[model samples]
Target: MATWLTTFSYWLLIQSFVITIILLPLSHLLVSYLPLYLFNYRSHDSPSRYLLFITLFIPFTIIFLLITDLSHIVILLFFVWFSVLLGFIDHQTGYLPDLLVYPLLVLALLFHAMQSNEQLLLAIYGALVSYLIFWFIYGFFKLAIKRRGLAQGDIKLVAAYGAWLGVYILPYLMLLSACLGLLNYILLWIKIRYKPDKIAFGPALASAGIGLMLIKYFKEDWLIKIIL
Candidate 1:
């Protein structure tokens, strides 16, 4: 058990930090291609070449070193991959695509079926509840503030997190993302002063999702200590 816990923690760290950097520019390329196809832009750079290299090369190295259960690792990768993918698009376009979001829900359902029989119901319930929460919050804040504090895209992102991580993790992902966003906003606000420059929420979302997956596998005492 201890051995599994330690390995899982290391895996979480890699997914949040190392895998994020590894996937960064490649996801950027995905945005480039899909956008061009959607809008027919001529000047976009090719993001395909890097796509092949990152997906193939990095996983090869990680699996080579880890030599653990492939099923477990693949499940972990599913959540992190979507988080990075969403983050990349949010940074570039300021909107999350319904195209991507729906497909991801399908993938989450697939993951739910294969890896998590017991957990699937709770996860789905979380998704629906969180989706409503964000939707309601979006409207109320818009009415009260007379300005959009968060976007529908962000609600979809939060809903996705809830779907994949379950109700218990819903709060953690939000709290973690908010903390990181607060820190980021303060720093960026100090420097840029409400310029509406496209900031990256993807990384925070990805980081928080990763934390959700890993925290449960640790010893409870350590988890509580970290929370404190």
Candidate 2:
């Protein structure tokens, strides 16, 4: 069984890599134009070349990590792809479209259901828990700071992540996201010599999600041990 899983994992890694390279350019184009079509406003001034590099880099990295285990490859890939998409969109426009996020949530739920009813319940609980946590944070920011701290899209993005990764991973995800976000802020500040008024949270969260998935892929036994 382990040998079969290893063989299948290698095959999936190769297949997913090829597919990612083929689809990435198209994904970039879609990310570029879709918002314009839907909102009649260009989400970004122009797509950054660096964005293209990061976009291609993440899935390749994730697929490489998954080559040792295929247990969650399909769902993980789906989550990675959409997370990348939504991250790009949110970074550019400060919006996470329902068109992408809703489908991701549905896919997570369906995939979890395929595994077991218990998993499906956990996914649902994860979604609600994460959403409520973010919602509370958002409300607190509004009341305390007299400004929106987290956007609705960000809340939904976290909820989608919870649906896919489950409640157990939420604390790690949040911590990673906060750390990455701070790092991003520092880099941007260093580059521009001023703090940017707005920082995008989606990229950090997406990155954290990918990191967690990689951990699950490569250290499933360790994770299980820790959880148990």
Candidate 3:
């Protein structure tokens, strides 16, 4: 058992390194070109390639080491990859392309569908309910603040999280994301000495979604205690 575990860990390390090398340039190209394709203009919001590589590598390695189930690892890694890419795009350009998000939503539903009927139902409910709730909030904030409080893309992103993680995680996801957003706002204020006009919230959503998924799967009592 020990030998098998050692071999598995070694191979995982090599595979993750190779995958990160391949994904780094690919990620760079996507972030650089996707904006031009979608909006007919280039964006300067692309994060540093080195930073992107590190971000991908760390998660890839950590997930590979933690998840023993091959199927779950594949699906979770794909989801994380998408989350990172979407987060970066939204962070840089303040836009979330439907091209990426719609596909992710469909994939999440399909994944749940394969699990069982009950799980599929939960995923569907999650998506629909989250969309409606966010839509109402968006409208209310737009009316109250005289400006759009959340983007349509953000609503879709939240719905995607519901579909991926299930309905039970929605409240925790929202709370964590809200806390992260406030921290982001405060940090930016301190750095710039004023409130910024906009915050790219998709990153916060993506991060919270990933964190909640980890907590859900690992069943870490101490982690859950800290989070809740």
Candidate 4:
């Protein structure tokens, strides 16, 4: 099994390079037009260059495949692809367009369905519960502060994550994302020496969700072995 896994890992790595090359141009186009068409948001004149973008995800894709099962590669790929795109868009424009988030939720439900009816049910419950919880937080915070504490897009994104990860993981997802956001806030404050009116939460949420998946699907101690 170890020998087969090692061989398969190498094969997958090569395939990932080919896949990333194909995905790069298409992803660039999607990022460029999707927001323009769907949300009337302007695309950046100078988006991150292709080389830099590829550099960001290549290591993540490698670690993702090394730990992921062959059976899950397709759905997980979509999850990562959509989440990364959403993260990038939000970071760039401060908008998580429904065009992306809704499809993300639907795909996650379909992915859960492929596992079992029970899993699908859990995903539904997870989505509903997560949405309500975040919605409440948004409402309460807004009432207290006379400003929107969380964007509607971020609330929906959290619900989509619950759909993907199931209800059992919602607390961990929220806690980790909060910690990440707080850390980001601290760094931004140090850099600018004042409280910024707003900071992007989408990136932190996306990173936390992916981080939880790595923990959930950890395959042996392969990463540790490589580090040593």
RMSD of each: 5.5, 3.4, 2.9, 3.8
Query: How would you encode candidate 2's per-residue C-alpha lDDT over 38-64 as one tens digit per residue?
Result: 666575376774666567566665565
| Candidate 2 TM-score, C-alpha based | 0.84
Instruction: State every prediction's TM-score relative to the real structure.
Output: 0.70, 0.84, 0.89, 0.84
Q: Give the alpha carbon lDDT tens digit for every residue of 1-228 in model 1.
A: 334334555555455456556666666666666555653544444444455345434443343244366675665565556655665555555566666766666666666777667777876887898899878887998999786667877888777778877787687787889898777767888887775444666557756765665555333545545873
Whose TM-score is greatest here? Answer: 3
lDDT of 3 by residue, 167-222 (tens): 88889888999998888888989999999998989889988988877677655555
- Per-candidate clash tally: 1, 0, 0, 0
Q: Which TM-score value belongs to model 1?
A: 0.70
Distance from true location, Cα of 31 in model 1, Å: 3.4
- True-structure lDDT of candidate 2: 0.78
Instruction: For candidate 1, give the lDDT of residue 34.
Output: 53
After superposition, the stretches of candidate 2 with alpha carbons farther than 4 Å from their true spots are: 1-14, 43-45, 48-54, 57-61, 64-72, 221-228
State the lDDT at 195 in candidate 4.
100
Please name the candidate that would achieve the greatest lDDT relative to the true structure: 3
Order the candidates by lDDT, highest first.
3, 4, 2, 1
Instruction: Score each candidate by Cα lDDT.
Output: 0.63, 0.78, 0.83, 0.79
Q: Which ten residues in a row have the lowest lDDT in candidate 4?
A: 219-228
Report how far off residue 47 is in candidate 4 (Å): 2.7
Estimate the lDDT of model 4.
0.79
